[model samples]
Target: MLVLEGVSRRFGAKSAVEGVELSIERGSFIGVIGRSGAGKSTLLRMINRLIDPTSGRIALDDVDVSALRGKELREWRARCAMIFQQFNLVGRLDVLTNVLMGRLNKVPTHRSLMRLWSDEDIAIALTALEQFDMGSFAAQRADQLSGGQQQRVAIARALVQEPEIILADEPIASLDPRNTKLVMDSLSRINRDYGITVFCNLHSLDLARAYCGRLIGMSQGRVVFDGGPFDLTEDVARQLYGLEAGDVIDMPEEMPAAVVAAQAATPPVLAAH
Candidate 1:
């Protein structure tokens, strides 16, 4: 379990996050939604120590996450992998080498710097690519792939880390509808099949409802609601978005045909628990 007690962050006179508290159980697929600057990204970054909380504590399974430093902090980060809004891949590197970078913490610094990976490490990386149906692109440059394909390669990189928790900061914010569905499906599969805890920041209420088992609504640096997808009624959405009821009532319910076709073309691979 992960616990945040009175967590808050401030930049001089402004507060990014304030007095936030949450208890996240293992294997939960949670979606954090809010308008821009609602502090969604800041909260996720604090959990992995990417950003320090100005007040309160963050704990994971009874370990004080806020207190870790140096090598300890690095190890904690390895266990809690982060996926960015922009697929953070080395464009010039071959897909396989990019995936292999996940093993940097486990391998010696010298070997990693020289890109001298063992056969077993190479096999593991390849297996990760296969899981996402990107095995054939292992030798291709990351920059050459489409946005959807590049995102899959990013997922493969995260999988090779063998992380206990995955924090996705708007993983599909930049993708087209088709690519969005594919990426969301991949995340859902990872959460369900591998039992990896997933905390994602999402802008679209529809996509959040479709994939996440639980939704956490934030407004102005505070949690406004915490409940299942079905519990997120029209009123709740309005409150979450800081909009009038009519603004949210007209939201789309169905996935695009392109997204459906993409999903059909690539059935998600269930990761081994």
Candidate 2:
């Protein structure tokens, strides 16, 4: 389980995150949805210890992850893998090589620079590819695949680590409708098949409603709503987005204009968990 005990972050007089306290179960697929600058990304960063909380603690299975430093922190970070909105793959490297990169912590830095990986690493990378149904693209360079395929490769890279938790920061924000479903489906599969707890920050309400078991809404660094998707309502959405909710949703132009514009606007509505 992951625990956020009164986590807060402040930069001078501006507070990015407030006293946000939440607990996530071991296998829960949680979605964090809210407006931009609401501290959704900040909260996700704190889970992996990429960003430190100013006044509280984050724990992974009873371990104080936020307090871990140096080598210990590195090892703890290895337990959770992060998936970015933009697929952060080595563009020039083959897909298999990119997935193999997940083993860098276990390999010496010298060997990593030389791209020397053990046979086990190759096997694990292959297994990851198979899991994502991208085995045929193993030899293709990362940049050669389409955006959806690239995101799948990134997911494969994360799975190769066998991490217990995954933190995805608006993972499908850049994808088209078809690609978005593909990426979200892949993540859901990972959560069920491997029992890896997924904590995602998203922008689409429909997508979140479709996939996540639990939903969390944030605004200005404070958690406004936290519960199951069944608990979500128009009233709750209004609370999350304020007066702009109706004006925004009532906009008309295309079939998916609401989501298309939302994705393009300042205060985004993300999908996850």
Q: Report the number of the highest-TM-score candidate.
A: 1
Candidate 1 clash pair list: none
After superposition of all CA atoms, the RMSD between model 1 and the true structure is 7.4
Q: Count the backbone clashes (under 3 Å) in each candidate.
A: 0, 9
lDDT of 2: 0.81
TM-score of 2: 0.88
- What global local distance difference test value does model 1 have? 0.85
Stretches of candidate 1 above 4 Å error? 244-273
What is the C-alpha lDDT profile of model 1 across 9-97, one tens digit per residue? Answer: 99999999998878888888888988889899999999988999999999998789999999999999999999998889999999999
Clashing pairs in 2: 202-270, 202-271, 203-269, 203-270, 203-271, 204-269, 204-270, 204-271, 212-273
lDDT of 2 at 39: 92
Q: Estimated TM-score per prediction?
A: 0.90, 0.88
